[model samples]
Target: MSHAAALTLPFDTDTILEGLKSWAACESPTFDAAAVNRMMDIAGRELALLGANIDRIPGRLGLGDCVRARFPHPSGETTAGILILAHLDTVHPIGTLEKLPIRVEGPLCYGPGICDMKGGTYIAVEAIRQLLRAKVATPLPITVLLTCDEEIGSPSTRDLIEAEAARARYVLVPEPARPDGGVVTGRYAIARFNLRATGKPSHAGSRLGEGRSAIREICRQTLAIEEMTTEDCTFSVGVIHGGQWVNCVATHCDAEALSMAKRQEDLDAGVAKMLGLRATGNDVSLEVKRGVTRPVWEPDAGVMALYDKARYIANAIGFDIAHQSSGGGSDGNFTGAMGVPTLDGLGVSGAKMHTLEEHIEIASLVPRARLIAGLLTTLGA
Candidate 1:
């Protein structure tokens, strides 16, 4: 029997919309620990009500806490099972809800974090709810882990996420589906670094030769770094700061650099090149600090098997499914690289992420929920 034919949603569309609205109303920006904790509290309550064991794991390294919900197998089998990964935090700051209210207009619901992931997170919850209401016995345990620092590279939770993935039979990340309705099978490896240059300051006009400008040194190195971009690896210098006064030779300059690569070897080569850069000017010195390093999610045999199962589920619902690789990185990167079967981008369908126009297609909500429900049921079977 088809998974879709075997499953049914316990709640209606209105219930899911209400849940999303409640989540979107609470602005849980990644940097604000309190705000993110509030969002987690709300979700914790909902999951607790559903008879799942809820744990609010405290955050370390200046990040908000994470909430983990467990639906153990009735048969008490405790090997590895299904894992659902998501994030409660978004890029939007507090008070954003005032400008971008959670309102429904025709087929789209406008709000902060709705499309980026609030919608997706709730859909996962609803899928589990559907399975429970149908009294279907799950063959394996299910775990839902929602972290608070994913928007900021998951620095505090990377180890925890990897640990969970190590124990999971398969991982699913509902991070907003691609605009073309394709799921992500692979993702680029990413690295972040901070570059700083220091030198002596002097008057630009009167003592030009007496000083070596850090700004000039940094600019030269920046150009060299940008030139390192290739089809396999790319570099971006996003934030640059230098010189307080235009008439004075800058004593210090700094820049934030981000690099992405399609392969691990390319990323290693790019990192070595970036770290090898030194001050070309005589009086200037350079410093580089490494930031987060996200491994590439390369498609493997396990990933292909998960995609085939997803395609089968989609086809049972009367729609064709497609898979693609992305340049962006997610928690899936850690899991996929760890050799776990990971299927990402299995969330609500929408476009314009990380902007005021972020919204989800109202029409796509229920069907996608049904799809998730079907997948969960099929996996349990």
Candidate 2:
């Protein structure tokens, strides 16, 4: 049967829109624990209406609950099923959502985090609703885990996510479909690191010879790091703040990095380059803290087996789905690295994430929701 035909809830557009509007009203900034919790509150209320039992999981750093809502089949079977993963945290701050609410600009639903994840969250809930209404009892039980810290690295919830994925036969991430509507089979493993350079303080003008400017040491190293970044690898000095005053020789300087690529060699080489950057001609104490986090998500035979199943699910939906790899990272990176059958970009087709122009397509909702619902209903059954 077609997804539209299989759907029992009639694809309630009003319901979805209302849910999105109500959700967008709340600011769910991952940077702010309170904000994320508020967004989770909105999610809980909406999920409750569908007869799902929602509970608050303890968060290490946030006020919002890492919700684990259960909707068991009447048969009471909880053996196994597809684990739907969608992060509730967004990169935007509290005011972005309300100040930048989702608007129908043409056929798009524009809002902060709408593309990167809020839309995926929408599809996750909507798909479950469709599946429940159709009375499709998954062969395995279904568990929907919405973590509040995905934007900042799973941190507290990553262990929980891995435990869940390890038990389930399949995992699906609704991180927003690609512009061409391609699903992601592989993602670059992400590693975030910070670097700081310290030096002697002396007058920049009078005692310039006595001063070992940490600022100068950092600047030279920045150039070396820039040289390390290549086409295949992406490394950025995303944050930089330092120095005491203009006249005095600045004693401190620092920079933060967000790094990624397909190969470990690339990441390691990049790290070595940063860590090996000694005090350039200056008398400075240069320090590089090794903070390599997150493993890579390469497509392996086992994950490929699961992709076959996903492709089959797509075929059943009157479409032939294709897979792609990405340099961006997600919790899916953690799971996928574990060799789970992880599929990403399973949400609505939208782009411009982490920016004010982010959006999800109104038209893509039904199709993507159908695809997600189908994956949930068919996998591991």
Candidate 3:
């Protein structure tokens, strides 16, 4: 198919927006297995309608199951394929739809998960749909894997994503495009950690000196962790839970923290500093546990090749494209780190992700979807 033809597909804006609204209304939070399962069912059914062979991978360890869809090459060449990596889960909890309902204000669509990924997910679907309608034939197979727990670091789906990426020749992550219209060619290394402090509890009025305050210990540690930030590595304590009452000294405090680094050495150094944090008081004890450790996705020759193709398509469609390294983690991080060529941030252009004000540019829907279709057609050729 010609690039011009691919960019001019009769993508019905109303139809695409309606589809996004439907998916966004489902509220598939990462922690809610049942809700995410429902989302997987919806996505699976849609993919099946598009003639894909669907496989419902079961959930594990309290996460919702993943849905895998395969579109075999028309010519029977299946040794290599294109992998479309995405997630259906959102950070918004259930009942967010009422407050952040899907609405269109001029060129933007507002809703929970719309900008972050739901928009991107639908973009992938429509891209393939348009490709099929155009009757373009590709020699390489196409696969789409929509996992359940990406918002929480993709703990369960990492292995599945890597395994699929290992077989495919290219991996495309349809995350939302950057605010400045750049795609992602590299991603930072990230680590999740939880810090806890334990101390003696006593009434503040009755025994002030006798009791050691865990809250105080945690505050001290938080300050230290915050101070560990540098030009490359950054740390933030996102969550904290502690204290009982004003009249009593708290016995326990816990915090959820994460660190991001552009380079592996910086990440290692930052981790060492975080782990080496000492307790201010002798009576207070500290416990630090590491959670997910996502390796940095450094740019490579393969990525540059992919970008060359993408740039060609963007130029064909009358726009300029750019690339940047993001601090956020995606399944692309896993694949790219494993030496698989990966291109990310091919979704809609929007902002305020993970917030109630999240939204996407309505005008970007057709062009971005066409860009994806263009890439697929080029790869298959």
Candidate 4:
């Protein structure tokens, strides 16, 4: 239920903050492949400087690249390396960096993608810096994976992530645990959906009785589906467009949305129920495409061990931190779901992800950097 405190080495807070600044200079937007590539170039250069052997792997659905780096023990033994996964692309756009640059005001660094992963990337990068500078070789080697499309559910880089994860003894995701600096032991699974309802269209005025209103039927299904949603799993109509003419009965109805589940069974139940519902007396058609890209990373015993390790380290460093589960999904979802001992929320904290309001707790920079350094030390031993 508890763990021993961890050990730490000396590192400069200023230098680490500078490292964060260097990362913020690039506008790594996941939606823009060009921007993603540019961010990859930046990550590659810094990782190379930190003594990692870097490579560029092509993406699945974008022009961006999955940049991977490895630092093997001098002995070249297969037994000694841990994989560090981070993403090069932030959720912010190209113009975001300009309008909202990294600024340390009070205890927060307000900027784009500051806490999501950019801040975490710097923590990982700096951990490498300290290790290299100290010439502290671990019993385990280290591999760093920086992807260009993490925000987009990592659709383009999941394969590479899984491949790298397969070889490592430990996996760390700097997803910015929480403002309190607690770690994430488990996160909800993600399921995206595209639902459509169809019906014949006719004049709304005279022939209303003869025509089947797709929009009306869709509204009914939407309400029915809305009631189907529960707190454990959620569904929504993010985008909906139906009807060609205002006076005419709508012929077609369509909607696209994202759904999430805290548990696998609940997710399945939600999806199954949504699909099973048939058209009502109006003779409407129903079609649902169920898509689950991210599996739920349950907080199983193995995952709990990693969080325990982090908690132990925090305690050792005079910080009593607790690990909690979240509704969000991270790269840890895949690795942990695959049965790897994984830990996430190791990045900076500032809240407001996927929005321009995203930022980092400036005060958390050095502490999180030290936290990561301490975590790596534990992994090495």
Any runs in candidate 4 off by more than 4 Å, and if so which? 1-10, 75-77, 98-101, 196-224, 239-254, 277-286
Of candidates 4 and 3, the better by TM-score: 3
The deviation in Å at residue 317 for candidate 2 is 3.8
Q: Looking at candidate 1, what is the lDDT of residue 90?
A: 96
Q: What digit string (tens of lDDT, one per residue) describes model 2 on residues 319-366?
A: 776888876778888889887788988888877888888877787777
Give model 4's TM-score versus the native structure. Answer: 0.85
Model 3 per-residue lDDT tens digits across residues 1-381: 456667767787789889988999888999999999999999999999999999999999899999999986665535778999999999999999888988999888999999889999898899999878877765578999999998888889888999899888999999999888879999999998989999999989989988999988888888888888889899999989999798999999999999999999999988887887778878999999888889999989999899888889988887878999898898888999998889999999999999989999998888788888888878756
- Model 1 C-alpha lDDT per residue in residues 72-157, reported as the tens digit of each score: 67655366888999999999999898888889898889999998899989998888877777776666788899999988688999
Minimal lDDT window, size 10, model 3? 71-80
- The regions of model 2 sitting more than 4 angstroms off are 1-9, 61-65, 74-78, 97-99, 202-212, 244-249, 315-318
List the RMSD of every prediction in angstroms: 2.5, 2.8, 1.6, 3.9
* Deviation of model 1 at 374, angstroms: 1.3
Q: Considering every candidate listed, which one attains the maximal TM-score?
A: 3
Off by over 4 Å in 3: 1-5, 75-78, 244-248
Better of 2 and 4 by TM-score: 2
